[model samples]
Target: MRLPVRIALLLILFFCADLCFSYVQKELRPQTALQERDIPNALHPLVKQNAELLQTAALKKGITVVITEGFRSIEEQNELYRQGRSKKGNIVTYAKGGESYHNYGLAIDFALQKKDGSLIWDMTYDGNQNGRPDWLEVVSIAKTLGFDWGGDWRNFKDYPHLQMIPG
Candidate 1:
């Protein structure tokens, strides 16, 4: 083969290899990590503002909260729905694909952030020592910010979920 042709072929192979590696790396990342990383950029404007307020209010009450998920894609929602039914994990959600508010960028899932920076979804954890669970405190603050807590749902209590419905 000509030298120029060989060089071009080598560059093409390198580009293809690089693309594949990038895709593999992304696919290997934990789903929660991806969602958390995308939260700030993926949420709707009003939802984001309210989430910020909720976080601030929770903090003032000596509770440290973290948004674990925001603006879920339909594909991600489907994957969640499949859990327990078709997947190995326990069922985490009833909503599938477009059915959830997260698909519309209006929903967020939160967790408690301990002082050591570890996250927990324990609803009974009262890290703030305020006689009330920090999770409930965050929920109260979220409600004040116009977010509806999924924990209020009768059918499925998703304690981590909150969403704002537009008027």
Candidate 2:
């Protein structure tokens, strides 16, 4: 009887140890995503905050603006740089890989969305008919929120781009 009780106790202890080990493994395991297009965790917090504020204010003005690009990887930036010079399409960007502020999570590009959900990159578009261009309004709000508009740059006019200069 004593031997049987000892065996049962040993089995119970073994089972409890296995369960504890499994719990610890589950807790320490890294998490992964099911979707590839999900927003990356590396976006700077200030960029996210200002982008959200810009979106909210645009919505209130009946102007729908969507952030189309942010935080591009060096590889992605390189591909964009190749577009007009090496590749077939028009030159979309002047900055190569590491040179873009997008590579540092400080820049974002936006496009206007019409009520029917069509996206437009036209800077003079006034989909809400608010008398002012929607793109300019977005740039204005972005400036107030601490972003510098790429449209104001004298060399390359990138109307959709907004960047936060690090001080």
Candidate 3:
């Protein structure tokens, strides 16, 4: 093969490789950061306060709850909306970017944290030995704190979702 053609091919391969890496990184970032990051500063003050209270209340019941999402950016929401549609995961959300209360910092998604420190989404897991499911307990607390449970939605039940709307 000619030297110039070989050099051109190498450059093309490098460009393609870079593009692929960038795409993968972009796709993985939100999922990777889901429960790892702190609750976003963009959350409404009252919502943030209630979230903390909800956690404390759950902890008192021997259930550790972790906020998995808060104050999502439009781009992140779009990425999530792509799942099970344009992407390779189950459809986790029905709302698009601007449609979700998360876009405005009024919503959150939560999971139960086990004694082992790992998170689980199992709604029926009763790690606390409570006859009542811990997930429902948390939802009850969240509702008292003024959060609307997505699990109650008639159309789509997003069990992990909680949102506060001004009255």
lDDT of 3 by residue, 46-154 (tens): 8889999999999999999999998888788899999999999899888787777887788889999999999999988998997989999999999989998989987
TM-score of each: 0.73, 0.73, 0.74
Ranking by lDDT: 3, 1, 2
lDDT of 1 at 125: 93
| Residues 53-115, model 1: lDDT tens digits | 888888888898899899888889899999999999999888887677787787999999999
Candidate 2, superposed: residue stretches over 4 Å from native:
1-41
Give the per-residue Cα lDDT of candidate 1 at 67.
92
Which of the numbered candidates is closest to the native, going by highest lDDT? 3
lDDT of 2 by residue, 76-137 (tens): 99999999888999998998876777877778999999988999998888888879988888
Residue pair clashes in candidate 2: none
Alpha-carbon shift of residue 106 in model 3 (angstroms): 0.5
lDDT of 2: 0.82
Q: What's model 2's TM-score?
A: 0.73
